[model samples]
Target: MSRFDENKFRAVTWVQRHIANPLTRRLPFQTVLETTGRKSGLPRRTPVGGRRIGREFWLVSEYGEKSQYVRNIQADPRVRVRIMGKWHTGTAHLVPEDDARARLKSLPRLNSAAVRAVGTNLLTVRVDLTD
Candidate 1:
């Protein structure tokens, strides 16, 4: 990565980790993705913006594999997603072949816009809900 991109990534992640995520995860109506920590053997919940379509929940990771939640999903696809105040179990899949920018068009607009603006290596993730 170039210096600029690396710097941006650091800045964005810092803010998300220390500020945005901590606050959002507490919101009752906020959508949350829960993944088992790859190394810690604990649940890590992240506030995410996505919509559930039938049995699948689709989202784009702005930082791709570099994101901690993505790495956790790589370690274990089993996950839990909270949608509209209800939790559902699922298996997460990282779809590298999908057109992430196009996929974003189908997601919530405000998030898509933020992802488009801040994302450098966008990646699509689909969670197939089991229940």
Candidate 2:
């Protein structure tokens, strides 16, 4: 990555981690994805924006594999997602073959707009709800 991209990534992630995420994750209506910490072996919940379709939940990760939650998913695919105050268990899958930009078009507008604006390596993740 170029210096500019690296710097941008650090800046954006820092804001999300320390500021935006902490606030958003507390919202009762915010969609949350709970993944096992890759190394910590504890549950890590992150605020995410996605749409549920049938038995699946689709979302775009702005930072791809670099995102902490994405790395957690890579380590353990099993996850729990809270949507509209209800929790659902699922397995997360990273779909590199999917067109993330096109997928974003079908998601919630406000979040998609932000993702598109700040995302460095857009990646599509599909979670198949088990219950």
Candidate 3:
């Protein structure tokens, strides 16, 4: 990564970890993705933006593999998603072949705009809900 990219990464990470994550996780309307920690073996919840259709939830990760939650999903696909205060179990899939920018257009607007603006390694993810 270039120096600029690295710097942006740090900035975004800091904002998400310290400010965004704490507040968003507490919001009842915020969608949260829960994955088992790859190293610590504990649940890790990340505030995400997505919409559920039938038995699937679609989202685009702004940082793709670099995102901590995405990394956890890589280690363990089995996950849980909290949508509108309800928890649902699912399996996450990283869709590298999909068009992330286009996928974002189909998702919630506010998040899609943020992701498009700050995201450098965009990638698509799909969660297949089990129940």
The local distance difference test score of each candidate is 0.97, 0.97, 0.94
Q: TM-scores, in order shown? A: 0.98, 0.98, 0.98
Determine which window of 10 residues in candidate 1 has minimal summed lDDT: 1-10
Worst 10 residues of 2 by lDDT: 1-10
Residue-by-residue lDDT tens digits, candidate 2, 1-131: 67887899999999999999999999999999999998999999999999999999999999899999999999999999999999999999999999999999999999999999989899999999999
Model 3 residue runs over 4 Å out of place are none
lDDT of 3 by residue, 53-108 (tens): 89999999888899999999999999999999999999999999999999998999
Q: Is candidate 2 or candidate 3 better by lDDT?
A: 2
lDDT of 3 at 114: 97
lDDT of 3 at 50: 88
